[model samples]
Target: MTGDHAARPGMAAPRLALAGWVLFDWAAQPFFSLVQTFGYAPYFVRVMVGDPVAGQAYWGYGTAVAALLIAVLSPTLGAIVDQMGRRKLWIGATGAIYALCCVLLWFCRPGEPGAIVMALAAVCVAAVAIEIAVMVNNAMLPGLVDRSHVGRLSGLGAALGNVGGVVATLLVLTLFVANPGTGKTLLGIAPILGLDGAHQEGARAIGPFSALWFGCFILPLLLFTPDARPIRTGTPTIRAGLSALRASLRELPRHPALLRFLIANMIYTDGLVALFAMGGIFASSILGWTAIQVGLFGMLVTTAGIAGALAGGSLVDRIGARAVVLLTLGLLMAALAGTLSLGPDHVGPWAVAPPRPDRVLFDSAAERVYLAIGTLIGLCSGALLASTRIVLIGLAPPDRLTQFFGLFALSGRVTAFLGPLSVAVATQLMASQRAGIAVLMVFFAVGMALLATVKTR
Candidate 1:
């Protein structure tokens, strides 16, 4: 399709319709924001499993499983969706599965005999479904309009998603999650629906809330975004897609720079994922933070992340994605160091006599230190993600950009399990969540070193 197709007056998709397309991100981020990062994830560690270290390991395993499925299936699914030409069908179907899995999370009560295992399975399935749906949603991008508005549209979409995360964090904090000691929200009231905060029902409620949030916000995309009419349709589409995917894999080795960058990204992005995945549990376990504190902290981090993404977008065009990736990775390394230095008994690696919670928000030296360092992690996470795609695009030949982008996604997925599994194994072996989290630094450092030598042009 010509770039001008979406920009011309007659051909352009309606503005409100386009806005709805961007709303996809706004609709989807609460899963990561509340369920995965801040709310229910911690509840798993603190309550469900009743052991922080074991809970971290179990959580990592779930993520690892999901990443494995995504890596194995995403490329083939993308190819099939392209052949089918009806992205909405896949998006709707996949989305329903994700929502159902999330709603089922309400069953993850602390004392239920199989609740933790069941929750893990639901999470794995839901995460895989979300990734697949996102793949289908992205595949529909070109057909929805044209290239002229793509960058701006994408930026708006991402910003809205980050903002959604912030809002979700705030809502979950004020409405559902209660302080560990007081069993009250920041609003100083009982959880909505009288959820038993004493038994952590309030915390576990993120599952159902995430489901409702996803379902309500995604209506615009389903109603407004246009789907491509299938060229081949159904069974034949899958067969053709498998054949095309096989050929594409055979073609990848000729593009060495793209290959290297993908490998580097695979290593680093997995590490980044692992860190954020463990962030909530780590805070709860080591810092003695309540659900309310974690929620408040998440609100702050998502806000910082949005600022970083905006800043990084400007910088990537000016300084090249390679430089941006290097700079962001460096910031993360430093942040990781700062994060590692903090423990309940210490501030910046200096161990002290048992310091108890005191004063106001982040009153203790350890909490203060962690907050400062964690802000840097938040800043780098969003920025690096924004920059990496541009870097990949810059490395690919214009004629083969689509194939290269697919390979890029494949690279990210192929070893996505490594970081989480490593964390899981490390945590289990050493019985330390910190040790597991610290392993991510190795990946970031390695990726930076690999990225330094890749040719961008």
Candidate 2:
């Protein structure tokens, strides 16, 4: 478990497995973007469920439930993986679970009894499984290359993921999402070989699409990724992992900087999650955008995310993690406040004529403005998250990665409820989704202030 263990002879093969690992994020994000956040969630509420309030509440519960499961299981599984020293096995198994759940989403037909419940369960299972996969993938980091390359490598993974998100969004927009006016896709074709707008089938197809995307892209990693040298057969890695967990928690006071970083990450990450998850919902409701508009917006953000992640990685290497995190967080605070301040018809608290939705992409001034702000937020989030991971790598004890990252995952999940819960509460109280959105800035502000005190070195 020494730092040298990560650099053992066979590790070279797994570093080439980076494509597969990065693709996992790419494959997974569309579900998060199109299905969970922008397209399906709102479509379910506004179109399928026929009640925005109910949809919002159900969505919040689903998210809360997913985070809860991840919180409970992330640490234990992380410890087990570390003890067993087979990160690839766990990654493969969890990837399958996530893909299957994504495929099952196609069955959640509109107006069906218990449809929302079923969909939420699929998402919850997928959420936990995906987190497990990420922890395993992350554990491979220190072993992949020299310490000098970790930040760049992490940034590259995130950037690849954004590219994948953009590609998926484009495909969905071309194949399924349509203009209500022309009833045509971005290609001006009839939604990929006659899949029409009838029955809202295009929207329904995203579930299976995401599943297939994940399944196909992960093959390279499974085939090419290297495995750790197996320990003696009689050793129970799971039991050892558990013991390690207890020891780590008792020992955390010795790593005060790591503890402080985790606390700050927990808060800011929650806020970031809340913002991205709800932005599409808010835009659709307030701006009266269709599925196509949402898709276009998503593509823009995805492109921005790629750029931001790469930039953040470079910045981390140059200025260090603390600078990158604080700078990005500051940008996040401004973006949140800016987004909340503007209405579809207004800019900077001034009201004007709302743009017509029927026009092409960026045709309306208001739409253009919204997309610009959305890109800014996306950029900062991408950079912040990628840089944060680098920071975690720097702070973790070399031998006990799973135990520490498990605690890291726990911090993310333990308070994940706060942001979504606040959104739900604010939506009801203020009679405006804007009020709920405005609540997110509180977490970012507090997280930044706390983060400033943590020492990376």
Candidate 3:
């Protein structure tokens, strides 16, 4: 009811509260890691749709729809939450919707009537709900700890998120998903729940699995994290919130530094999101990977992410978040270039590492090279994501934290549709996944250039 027990500025929060706050990231990550990036997406493209190109395009359009919705609603909702002043309630509401949508994904079976539509709808709604929950949770950060520990906490959250993703991916691979060839899980046994691998039921289980994980893990925050008291309620809150949002929009241009950072964040975050969305599709389509291979790849990348976030978090405190952001952006650009250069039989123009008829898991030199590149991408992505949040927290005004975080979500989502839509259109037109993903390079490059202009303390 009241935030009287919450940590004030210049004071440390209770360790319990900090842990609960950090665990929210842990709670949310399996949806991203398993459903979005590694497990269900690849299965959807390879098995459900049965055509990589069409599936990729469909996935892109679905993601674009989600991004557009988030773009339109996040800022307004953030402003309203600021007026209402109770973030945990909003987080709980959105999280419940997110979990329910995720559960619905279990019903999306191949060849079933309306299956693809159901899948896309569930993904879009879940994405929007989780994204809004994340924005609200992020706003709570400034209130939970003093300025000195913000970067550290941000980094810790990211690292823990990666850890959660890795663990979830492992669980899905070992217990649920089975290899089509052997019809056995990674542990060399039948899927525990009688999941039919032949029908791709194991892969579909990611939805309910993620939902269960979210429900179980999010409890700490609800129980332990302090929430600010409501300042207004009902129709009056809505009216005042709308008026406040209008004022914030008008005054935004006056805060040039925050504006610049938001734009830069917008661009780069688009690139990051597109990369994650497309990465598994690229692997499954180009390299002829299956569920097991993609899951292993997810584990590798997420482990690297854990290392990167932890290191970046510590580095941000010493070298400054801006420097860490710049460094990671450069690294990500290089990784993207490396990723684009790779093919099944060759790295770039040279046709080396030709396909081996008896090839085992990722046996080709090119595949090994790609794995390395993906690890680099994962590392840089973790650092980049954490540092950007630190940068925003550093720049945003203290009183308008939630509103600014809403703007943060808006900026990230506004052009977010463009990233995936461009990829979808390019892939559709060029008939090449490579050409589509290449568009992300422009976003990272332009974002880096714009980021150079922002001043941070």
User: TM-score: which candidate is best?
Assistant: 1
Per-residue alpha-carbon lDDT of model 2 for 206-321, expressed as tens digits? Answer: 87788788878777666665455555323487788778778877877889989888889999988987787778777777777778788888888778877787788889989997
Query: Candidate 1: which stretches are off by over 4 Å?
Result: 1-10, 351-359
lDDT of 1: 0.84
Task: For residues 96-150, write the lDDT of model 1, one tens digit per residue.
Answer: 9999999889987778889988999998999999989888877766655667667
Clashing pairs in 2: none
Worst 10 residues of 1 by lDDT: 1-10
Give the clash count for model 3. Answer: 0
At residue 299, give the lDDT of candidate 3. 93
Is candidate 1 or 3 superior in TM-score?
Answer: 1
Model 2 segments beyond 4 Å from truth?
1-7, 14-18, 142-152, 229-236, 317-320, 389-410
> Model 2 — which ten-residue stretch has the worst lDDT?
1-10
Alpha-carbon error at 87 in model 2, in Å? 3.6
- State how far residue 273 of model 2 sits from its true place (Å): 1.0
